[model samples]
Target chain A: MSGAKPKLTTSAMIASLAAEGHRTSGAPFGHALVALAQTRLDIVGMTADLAKYTDLHVFAAAYPDRFYQMGMAEQLLMGAAAGMAREGLVPFVTTYAVFAARRAYDFVCLAIAEEKLDVKICCALPGLTSGYGPSHQATEDIAIFRGMPNLVIVDPCDAFDIAQAVPAIAAYKGPVYMRLLRGQVPLLLDEYDYRFELGRAKLLRDGADVLVISSGLMTMRALEAAKRLEADRVGVAVLHTPTIKPLDEATILEHAAKPGRIVVVAENHSVNGGLGEAVAALLLRNRIAPPFHQIGLPDAFLAAGALPTLHDRYGISTTAVAERIKSWL
Target chain B: MADPSTVSRRSNVSLAQRAWRIRRNALRMAAVQGQGYIGQALGVADVLAVSYFHALRYRPEEPLWEGRDRFLLSVGHYAIALYAALIEAGIIPESELETYGTDDSRLPMSGMASYTPGMEISGGSLGQGLAIAVGVCLGLRRKNVNAFVVNLLSDGELDEGATWEAAMSAAHWRLDRLIALVDVNNQQADGPSSRVLGFEPLVAKWESFGWHAQRVDGNSIPALVAAFDAARALTEPRPRVILCDTRMACGVDFLERREKTHFLRVEPDEWDAALAALGEMPA
Candidate 1:
């Protein structure tokens, strides 16, 4: 074979995308997992032939003995993780959010959640992150997993939250379905000095004009929007909710109860049954309904395009979020 | 308690005696409710006896022992059969059989891991057990824990694609310690399993999937014992499957001869006659 070809940088490959200039936290899942595996001998990495995509290849390379490649079988992947959990092994299973929430929902329900097995389902491409259309994007993953009892749902904002969540969910006994932000995932939570506590929400910025509540990638956008709004004198409070299920109700109510503060729920998921609906229900039940609005994808199969176009079209991009908040104000 | 080797060395006569007790317990539990998957319980008694008494290495007192072999009941409706075996193995109390299918009873009509001791999985939906067994076997091997994973599923379960998926993975992983016992009772909810879903050439199917496959008379104590022995003796790095050919009702002649024994609802008067045919006095 000839000399190794120079690898194409992520920026060079997806140059037209909005994620070009931002510094990635460096595949937090793979790096954090590899670091975690060094200490926790029981932690085993598994994937359904998406190891490289889900960033489980990092763990696979570090500890080849512990990683299991279940091929393209999502059901088997989840079932095997459940089995490993039964045998006192903590299995960190990686796959696409669509496959985990849709393809292997029953296995996740019966084997892992129903049985309350200690299996961490860390899936990539949650919500509008993937531009590969409806088939690849898991826009309603949270909605699907929300109804499932005994399942901890985490939607990490960025690489820091993902890094923190890996160890946190691992230490917490039971099943967790964590949406991953893979590849060159942006780093944002560190700047805000945010720490991912399992079920609690983190208040990144405080403002009186609008309380911008968000999770996953939307939180990143919400923070960016908040900063831009400050220049325009639109005070926005950003409450980053990493844990969607067992949602941080106390903090949500505290922020929502404030007068003259418009409560806006932003998420990278579908408007139906995700953070928006969840917060709406919480507010409605608690009788703390301020001027409310939800910023998320429509209740339909998203169209295929690049990440930037999809985010802009779905109104989850930083620019879209800032403009929406400005228009509402 | 004797080791698995010593237990396996026990005569077929003793194993047959154990099978009779297991059948009687199932009968007792079913009679208490006046209905259950009695046919399945009675039919699978021989395999359960061979597994719990001879083939398996488990401490009945310590159900969660790490080194113990796991037995997953893939067919949830077969909870009666597993409960009977668990009772015989001393994992559960025999008195609990009276409270079968009752409120707050450990012996539910269907098997649930949360409620029942010695139940490896909460099997209800068909085709889930084999996949779980594959994972358990792989986990055990990784930990260097020498233990076998015995997955007991029905012929009806073969219709599930997940079962075939798991079969492929088990073989691909070379899990020699995994053994799948398919109870081909030929009965299911819709009707006969064959008509519901044709899983015939089942032996060839399993063999083609890279498993050491065999077919044996499930109700026959000697045959089941021999099959279990042969499966355990295979030193090759390949999973094993024992396709057990069994009738709906194996012990009670009346029930065995009855049509639609899948979910047999015996008359109150027939209870005594059924027990009498099995050489057991009705309490």
Candidate 2:
């Protein structure tokens, strides 16, 4: 089924790249960055040796002169980005989500966030996207970063969202932490004809019985759940909020304000402080009381497993979300 | 704002006075609070004084100037030193120094970038500042605009694995614009670093990581200035590390001799005696 747009799927984007035998996430970010480079000369890229994992090698390929390989140093990656911002040039820093969140948090906090530099800290494999287990999974990335001042967090839903969000974040003035959906991520938002906005939420579908407030690729699963719920004659609206930090409270409160509305926050992250908690806080603080069902991984560290198995095990799949909403109703 | 050429040659008098004041004010500030990191403040006073007063270019009126040299105080307990320097540098009013460690003061126990002006990075969590400093360096480099990135750390911070990771990365990228100053006061919170985690031959360790490393008598003004001057002269891609062998509480006699390294507590009577014994601030 065509999501916001039917022409492209996340897998199809990756499959096209993979079909040509390109192996790492670094290739795509780098390639797309170079494509962005032709039009934008002010664009520069830096990596903490996750260039291969984050696919920034594509940009590295096009602008070898502008690309800096900082080598396994996430702190320097952020510092360099800040330095570039100081010089009136835009810098796109790439790394694994875990390293950006856990390893180089202080640098990101000080050099970028505190200073309010226009640095793009784009990270790949956010949440359970990585099979490398708890160490690599950035389950607590949003939680740790949400409290940081002047940082805009973006958890794009699919390839189309990523493609749209990249230029969107580039145009943004302050620092940004974009949770990357790499490796031919699914294209769901385009199917709904949704447009990207930094702090706005996109209501993919309308429903009356329950509202699925989701972000990132899980919004796709929410769409699938909504379709399934439609067959059961239960209305499930999908509110896709790509920008998680400056959370679109207006959209959240509007949908959740209705009585008997079941708000299910689905995400590929841990339940603690992820989309589930963010949405709940927004509703509760705004006095928009609704029965909330937080569908996400538990508080504990998730173990290493296959992608399909991990999603099913974590209860973030379409079937699992549908079942949880059915039970909540 | 003056051109880069004129800015460097502007004046050393104010900066020199700033060094003296940073030392004097730091001691006085520590005396007011009854006890604080006087040793660190006194040790790195010259370098901090130089950076704030002369060597670095910044706008006091515009703290967020795009072309300003960045300073990250990795050893946050040394806020007294920074407060003294910032005041002398005109980043804040000298009157603010009265509220040094007080409740209402913008100055907190540790350095916070959010509250303080001219504080490039908020530091206190130990080894994290170097990493943050690296971020500033990368940011500046990406813009192709050459700006100095200086990080001041304690000798004890060498024990943190994160410091090494930042050092390795900085050296790998050949961040010549970046400079790291190790306040080798030989003391940690527990005691002298030798007793805690001995980083003996620390210069060699930095050299092994591909950095241009040097040692300086941190208390000597000429030596500190010369060391920094030489560091700025290097053209290689490697970052520079300056090992400052500073005496804990260099200007004060009593606190320098105390076994306590973290926080020093002097009796009311001894406080006056200590201040008097320290005498006039060095020129």
Candidate 3:
């Protein structure tokens, strides 16, 4: 019943751990979705009793009457959302990444994705964000959902991107599987004044020496790697793409085709069919031959660990990203 | 169609010919496709005939009307019965029935809302349609609308745990606006449901779950009309359930005689005989 911004914000914690300038994408997506619900009547929200965790509580608070609490039934949660969508209401159904990706894939496939209904499935804790071990980490989420047809997958990088992408999704007409980065997230993206477009990638920086292509939370690490590598006399340009599916082949190929430039695809997802596989497919189909390195988790289920320890263990840190780029060079 | 309460005031004799016509249409549709779940389809033809001809409040010209009582066929394989009933209801033409299951036909083997009219939900995955029907009930109830929800399910489909979860929720919420009719045809895809999952004492299960339950001979038009009329009569704080005990191939001679007619391929030679067997029989 009270609104108080804690002095110990997530951005403050990030400043203490990493540096003064870093951003998170979680809370902004929650806030933007609330603002979107004001003008868009069709936007209805539901969660599997994780309203606070997924940050959809923002929308729930504004439109309490429209929200449905499907109490931990992830499959029914998705099915109910699809049912509401079938009735011409745009339902934003939220749950953890593991449940949405693994437990309810068939329901999502048959009800929402295959039927081509307009259900916005917002999933929290993609990859190793939740170090609750294999049970919580959804490292294989992108691989599973990407193989399904007619589903738009978006992995926003920072708070600014989440805020922008939320309104974009409300405008989009088909089904979308969005990865959430919840809770007092960092604010590194406000520096670039980034904008979001579904299935369209953004070009953050342009450098012919090397192309660091990254999406989702990994884009933050890629930007840091670019800054650190600049001090070492290696010119690098970071291209931050929050949209993974219907990937920005024009921009990806544009940078990959640049003469004497090496491409490094970075993601928090697995090696197979993640952003790495998607971009690789795009390059191969276009015949844009370039030296490429995939920076992502190996083909194994990650065990439970601390969030920071997990990111480091999986080689998704800025240091590991810098090392991958150095090896390609 | 007339209001169910008003239709129930008349005797089932008025609907005898319509029930036979629905059964005849179901057999022909299956015969044209050379295959269908006609056994299950035939089993539910009487109820569908009563609902389409005399009970449900709907307009054939307006399938998506807001005031219509929603009817969802939860078991998608029994779409032959739904297609036949929809055609009889005038939501679709008799000519389009020939295109059922063909490459470009709206009437596929399973029900899809995008392809067909009057299909409230896309079904095939068992135990899915009832939950959506619950959603429809909740949606209409919230608006203070006096609409009813009816979902046709199979005994075999009860093996799905989601159906029980939805059943518990519907009864606990006292969804008087909702009703579940079980097509208890005994036989399933592999064998009898009794041998497969053993859904014995089905009426007791519904009673224990807090639903007003009853059993009726599903093949009898008069019995089906009366059972549904009884379901509509309840105004208490619990949903009602009708257990429809029926033979696998209720209306056809060849299909009913065979033990392996669950997913029968009605051969070209057997089509005319199957149609003739169901031609004049009052379902």
Candidate 4:
């Protein structure tokens, strides 16, 4: 949307995902957790050393006694959270999605998910949120966790979605793994007056030309792209699916089954085991094959660079999503 | 905090007799499946005996009592051992030992909390128990719930970096009510635990990690009672660990002399031999 922006710096690598001049909310997850902890006395917060980065420091500061800093050990973080949940306390744990998925996968699987504990694992930097390189990029987190049973996975669109999602995850009596949109997350869903359900997909906007099924920051980008596509006389629909696992198949089939619309699955994750593949498998199994296109990162380790340039290069930014849809049309 | 010595309803000899029963229960369960983690169960019997009879506080009829001290089995393979203790304490039915590790059985080869009452955490995946115990202790502290937490881990589990990480955090949090019983049987899946990864100066490692550490022969009922009492008596604002150096198949001479006894498939004839050995030990 920015036609004339200043020269982007390396700081852009870790800059807020919010577009310039867009409304943003700071630390929605941390603040929402603090709000939930007040009424739910059993609610406790925990994190590895990424509290400041994941914005859980807000909750930690507010509830000093209820917070547990488990150092930099992700395995221990997941295990301890599982343990806490066993003893009648609900633990909301935060860390980088990369560490939760890659580093402590077995711990989460055997300890939290298998036991069906009421532990909320909120991880930041899902997919390519960071520009620091492959190490910081959690491009395959969804793929890693999608196979784990008894885990409810969420990929909130922005700060407003996260704010609505925190309590929803806690209210549900089981283990959850949500992707956190930390510090200065974009607030787009609030414009639609959207209320997030634990496992529901919300169709924010509708059109006849194309239907964009998305989650995470890509949903925000898809909403932006829908507006940009309007100028080109293209009517685009944005279906925001925050809950990735146990997908809202009823709503998805209802929307995607609408006749004569090109179905596009966009995500801030790798092409492997993401929303694109998930939707594809769903549509295939249900015997409804629409003309499909996927806008996801390539199946490779992405290079380290400024997030803006990386987003455009990998075709996930608003400009890229719009351009790709227009060319397909 | 419940002072264990004050709450005891039995003497050391009674505790020893319970140990024999625990060992007998474990051997019976293993015989049901014709195989199990019998070596570890036999080795850690006395630790479990002291834990249920002395150090911990709980209602045998009510496994999920809110005031109950948690006994976490981090070495999930030792499910047979913990199940034996639970049965002795009247938490689980003694008759259920017949159905152990069988189809539609509450007892599985590995431990899971949902499968049985009094079984706190799902384990079998080593190196994760101490972390869960740390969390339980943290939760207890937050709720101002006066309950101690005990985590039983294997020496082989010490090789897991997560154990050390949780160990460090427990001490950092000054979880004075948390106690760890490490079954240092000197045996792991590969070989002797010390040679497997060298957790020697183990006491120093735990102390450096900010824990009050103690070592005892895990098989000796008197020594375990003393160690449990010491861990409970400590006023230090830090986590405590009782490193029980145990012999695999402690009371059974034939199995005890065997070099490799980690996961045993006891011959059909050895069940009688094992029960006979337990009968020989002084109660």
What CAPRI class is candidate 4?
A: medium
User: If you assessed candidate 2 against the hidden native complex, which CAPRI class would it receive?
Assistant: acceptable
**Per-residue lDDT over A2-100 for candidate 1, one digit per residue giving the tens place of the 0 to 100 score:** 888663332221222225566676678999999888999999999999998888999999999999999899999998899999889999999999999
Candidate 3 lDDT, A98-202, residue by residue in tens:
899998887788778878889999988887677566888789899999889989999988677788889898799999999988786766777885678887777
Q: What is the lDDT of residue A208 in candidate 4?
A: 97
Collision pairs in model 3: A23-A186, A23-A187, A23-A188, A24-A185, A24-A186, A24-A187, A26-A181, A133-A304
Residue B67 in candidate 2 has what lDDT? 76
lDDT of 2 by residue, B142-164 (tens): 66658788899988889987788
Q: Judged by lDDT relative to the true structure, which candidate is superior, 2 or 4?
A: 4
* Collision pairs in model 4: B76-B124
TM-score quality measure for candidate 4:
0.96
lDDT of 3 by residue, B45-86 (tens): 877877777667776787887788888887888888999888
True contacts kept of 2: 0.48
Tens digit of lDDT per residue, candidate 4, span A1-329? 87887756655434688878999998999999899889999998889998898888998899998888899999989988987888789988989998999999999999999988899999988888887888889999999999999999999998889999999999999999999888888887888958999999999999999999999999989989999989989999999999999899999999999999999999999999988999999999999998999999999999787788889999999999999999998
Let me know the DockQ for model 4: 0.79
Instruction: State the iRMSD of every prediction, in order shown.
Output: 0.6, 3.4, 1.9, 0.9
Q: Candidate 1: misplaced stretches above 4 Å?
A: A1-20, B1-13, B280-283
Model 1 C-alpha lDDT versus the unseen true structure: 0.88
Please say which candidate is ahead in TM-score: 1 or 4. 4
- Regions of model 4 farther than 4 Å from truth: A1-7, B1-8, B11-13, B280-283
RMSD of each candidate?
4.8, 5.8, 5.3, 2.7
Assess candidate 2 and give its lDDT: 0.77
